[model samples]
Target: MTSDVRDTAVKDAARHEARLLWAGNRGLFALLAAARHTGPIARVPKLGWVVTDPVLARRVLNDHATFTMDGEGGVGHLWTQLFGPEMAQFFGGARHAEVRTRARDLFTEDGARSLVERSQGPWYAELARRLAGGETIDVADATRVLAGRLVSDLLGLPTDRDDDAFRAVFAAGERLAGLAMGTTASTELDPEVVERAREIVAEITSGVDAAYRAAGAGTILGRCREMDLGLPLARGLATLLAIAGTETGASGTSRTVALLHDTGQQHALLRDPGLMENAVREGLRVSTPAPVIGRHVARDAEVEGQRLRAGERILLLTYLATTGVGPFDIRREYVPETRQLWFGGGRHLCLGAAVARLQITRMLETLHSTGRPYRVVSRRAARRVLVPTYASLRIETHD
Candidate 1:
């Protein structure tokens, strides 16, 4: 086939595959099966271009020169806009490393412990109290609220109890998601949405900046300022931290609740409260919140016998990898020591993974300790389009 024909064919296949996977809940499982049996270098037209082998998954993520983080799709554009042009660490090699390193200190074990104590603990307590009040709560909504507050607090942002800031963020996310999934013509900010987004961003930025200004010399934000990272970089980092801190834990927690209620795993969890940690890990392994991650091939390389040229996109079907289709068997125990790629491989792996784990663990422990038997009311479950999430999971709790 001519190069044009080949490119067209690849694009067509990617669109089809993406639709199928998104349409069918079983796409995750299918991708894993393909990866295991096909030996990592499988063509997923649905996702466009490439899926890496297990061995190469590490190399693809780590090697910034040979593989780039910025892919051909509009998603990368949206990310750049949301995080700044220089934030394209996935595509830019050394630059990506530097940015990732600068923010690493915020997500360490000590950082996570402090975050949980100062932020997540109170949020969980509030959620527990609300649940105890006989309200039909959507766990996802609760998670979002808690995450937003925690993120805001961490960045020294003014997390007003007002709903406007939260609404603005949600609206921005919806517009961005639509743009990324090709559901919308453009993510060009609508006038109203743009205004709201700016308001929210300004509020967050000013709050964080003020905190840095007032903080003691040893504070995290204070230190970054002292190092002369500048206001823009500091603000960008704060925004990134807030969004990640809120979304990952919120989504994971809600999904875990949904899975347990759906699969009858809640009783199992209750029987062995000690199993909460394992169950959380299992849920993350099986249904990772951010299921798809991509990298760009920076240089000519051979993966699983397929010769990829520079600038080719390689999409990692992480949702599939988590399902244990090929080499993974979910029925067995998960050994974290051996299975390192769950959070991802190489330099760009999730910095906040430990924090996410702690959040999930605490949430699960609290729920299990309550000793409440809850049934998921399917009718009341709220569906989110962009992230493909459940807005609220209504649990009919029987004490």
Candidate 2:
């Protein structure tokens, strides 16, 4: 790796990421920065339990009986307030397992490939053509639109709308996620904040009501309906899909592009395309899209030799947990402890992990198709948003 592009790229990526933490939610940033020096599982003064060890983080996620997703500090708590108690209970009881079991097939490797092609193939083809023709395109913008298009298609939302509509959908999802930024201190959304989130959810789920009724058996909403999950729950499910699928995918893909280029590893990927898989994995590992995972203590439990009482909350500094392995290297082997901890562990593991990986694969393939390394003409980081990603990363392949 060249010292110039590689070194500055790392600095730029860090700057953007730090800004995201500092501007979006200082409380979260403080906890994450402090967790590095603290023990594996320590009680944060106002933030409850803060767990930076990958081992303990997974322990909390796996202990559904003790560390649950309901109550005041988990993200589900915010959703429950906006949607209702029925939704909150769903996160705790048997229903979550049931839904994950039923919906499992949709995210298999083959299924993810098909879903990505159906939702985003043509766009990638277009991008490939443009780069081949010497056009510098905004890869970051393309990922956001692509992310929007994929979520809508998966949920059987209206697709007659153009890229702008999907971009709007992506932006709305970001705004919806942004409303929760203040939740670092507490997952409880203020009544007025809840109202704003409701409006955003309505915008996000506007298509879900009809899609829930008419979507085919292949779509997620249809599966919910078949399972007797009513419109409200269906809306909740769709909104979750929208948030989970969009922001993280967009963030991970674009940042990966910048990371490879900034680190001057594009040449390595170009030489041995077999490393494509490693490249994608390294990107997501370094980026760790969700960055942090939160849980609410359901009962008195012991973790890392410390006891946590019911009603307490825990924060998993996953970025630190995963990044501790090493810096970004396409040659790096998988870390045993942090096996895909970014997508999370246990029942709540991200359903779209395969799709997210495939999306980045396609984008990298498209760039590689030109048979030459692409250079970053310019890039800008997104600010005050839930995910730390480039607002614009303009690039062009060598002609």
Candidate 3:
């Protein structure tokens, strides 16, 4: 592609991404827009401290002693309300580290690839077959089901049903995450909201009790039982896995597809298959599914010369932090400062990071296997959801 074409492609990708955010949540889009003008760290009126610089954002994530997830303004605060105070242990207490250590192998590269192949390989095969037959497939919808299938297999849930059954799994998780739509300025939830969330939690974990009892050691619930974490915490952890693994993974997958098409980078990947890894990284970086990360101040600390006191909150504008660098390019090298900041940093870094990457890599490879670049037929942005993504992104490969 010519330099002018590359520039135009870059702008087109940004436009589509902006629309997804706008359609998903206006408040989030506004915050991200404002962050562009703010300094590296600035305090907003009701939103607490906002950090847009990649370096500062990673610093807050790594500084667990000074910033916590269990207190006000953090995601854990929202979970504790729905799951009880014991849930706090999984956020900052020793239990957090213990759980990660115990479940470490399940999330490793080899383990992740095995899980992906076992749960989703067949679906990919079907998708590839359909594309090759000149069928237009909705990549976004496929991702939801794929995410549901992967999480179900990982949790040892019954995956013996149809695609709609797995779609229901994804839907339940989406409804649960939707409850947090009102939690941007405050992590605290209304009593009624908490009640509704618990109801949804029950729906998401309807099969967990049986799974925990009989699931093999390779599954997460099985590990929970081995750790003797009890039924309540097990339920909480299960719901967490459902939400954490599905929504972000689904969003990243679909958006990566759209990003490659919108930026005209799919042809580049088709030419140089070795750029597949870089393409995946650039996709996740450009379309950061979890655009904003919130943390509660644990104690007085200085970040970028700003003194933050306990009881306050900080919002890391990860979307702006990662995208501020540049547009998505398949050939772009790894960034030093933003080293996987999209997956987050420090001890709480996403345990399913490898799983997420492998999923995207598989998706790109499937599109490439057609031996012809695919064209997006149409796409609609998901609305009023925790993660901004496409509701339907239809595509058909050229003959």
- Candidate 3: lDDT over CA atoms? 0.91
When summed lDDT is taken over every stretch of 10 residues in candidate 2, the lowest stretch is 16-25
lDDT of 3 at 94: 93
| Cα TM-score of candidate 3 | 0.99
Query: On TM-score, who's better, 1 or 2?
Result: 2
Candidate 3 Cα deviation (angstroms), residue 296: 0.5
lDDT of 1 by residue, 1-399 (tens): 466754554354334334433542344435544565654566555454445344456666677567655545323434556556655544354644665566676678887777776766776776667667665655666666667666665565555666556545544444333334431223334455545545555655656768767644434466567666667666666655655566556667766666665555577677767676677777676556666666656678887678877755677656555554322122347654325455776666777788788877777765654578676664232333334445556664666
Model 3 worst lDDT run, 10 consecutive residues: 361-370
- Pitting candidate 1 against candidate 3, the one with the higher TM-score is 3
Off by over 4 Å in 2: 1-24
TM-score of 2: 0.96
- Residue pair clashes in candidate 2: none
Winning candidate number (lDDT)? 3
Q: TM-score for every candidate vs. truth? A: 0.76, 0.96, 0.99
